[model samples]
Target: MERYVDGFVIPVLNEQLDAYREMASEAGKLWIKHGALEYFEGVGDDMEPDMDGMPMVTFPQLADTESDETVVFSFIVFESRDHRDEVNAKVMEDPTMDSDNYEEEMPFDPERMAYGGFRSIVSYE
Candidate 1:
């Protein structure tokens, strides 16, 4: 079975990493409660890219991370595109997602965050 995913990458200030984790934890719980199969939030603690091979754009470069900032990569998985849509609809309506609250408490800059949906091409295991 194919799975769908909503992914995001955001650059956060080093000082705000802990606050970001708190927010991501709350969001993760909400997503799980709304039927997301899995929710992942990863902070870049060691983004040093090895130059042993072909170079590629890394999370730091992609998000233009600064020395005082760390990058966060996150995702929510669903059973399919329709399932993703359904879950998202519920998430939007949940009072826990109050826009004003988020705007005030967000740990990162919304305008600089990257977001997208993807369909899994292959899965092993």
Candidate 2:
């Protein structure tokens, strides 16, 4: 079965958008080069959550009322979980991954970044 990697990123503020985008772009490229089947990024909108508690907008959603922070939802697809692990191992060891120079301006708290691997339950597309 196919596997996937999902990442939820929360940006610190609008000023951090460019740096975050650059980081995501470089990471996506590295993943693809290391064997990812697909890579994507979604920008958030200003819409609010619906009555069902689901947001009617994109990522970078407000994390708090007093904060300008927003989240970025991104993911990568792989042929299998094993492939995902293998590619990830290589990606981690690659020097390019460490070259993301925006360390000081990282949008979200690294410890809080949500990420995980999952088996494909179903895919329509």
Candidate 3:
């Protein structure tokens, strides 16, 4: 049973773009180095039509119009849920976690940052 960490990020201000990207990239690398089997990052773009006749998936739209225009998303996959938890605990304890350069510029409200751990229910490849 593989485990995954999903992070949904929205950059509400242009000023936070550079910092957010840097943080996401570095975090991906750190996860891989610390024990994650796979790491990936994705950015939202203009939606295109899909076969379903609906617009392609887009970032979650906030109710507040004042929200920023970009979203940064990333994930880390592990061989098993227990392994994932172990690695995550170590990652948190590692001194480098606190040294992340983008910490000061976290764009979203911490209470509102969307994130979770999930077990793989199915996979095609």
- On lDDT, the leading prediction is 1
Local accuracy by lDDT, each model = 0.91, 0.69, 0.65
Candidate 3 clashing pairs, residues 3+ apart or interchain: 12-68
TM-score of each candidate structure, all chains considered together: 0.92, 0.75, 0.73
Tens digit per residue, CA lDDT, model 3, 14-96: 56666667777877888888898888877656423255775444455541224445555667788877888888888898778
Tens digits of per-residue lDDT, candidate 2, 34-116, equal 88989997666643545577535334333331256666667888888788889889999988757584456555467656677
lDDT agreement of model 3 with the native: 0.65
Candidate 1 lDDT over 1-125, as tens digits, reads: 99999999999999998899999999899989999999999998768778789778988999998889989999999999999999999999999887776655577898999999999999765
Stretches of candidate 1 exceeding 4 Å from the true structure: 100-103
Order by TM-score, highest first: 1, 2, 3
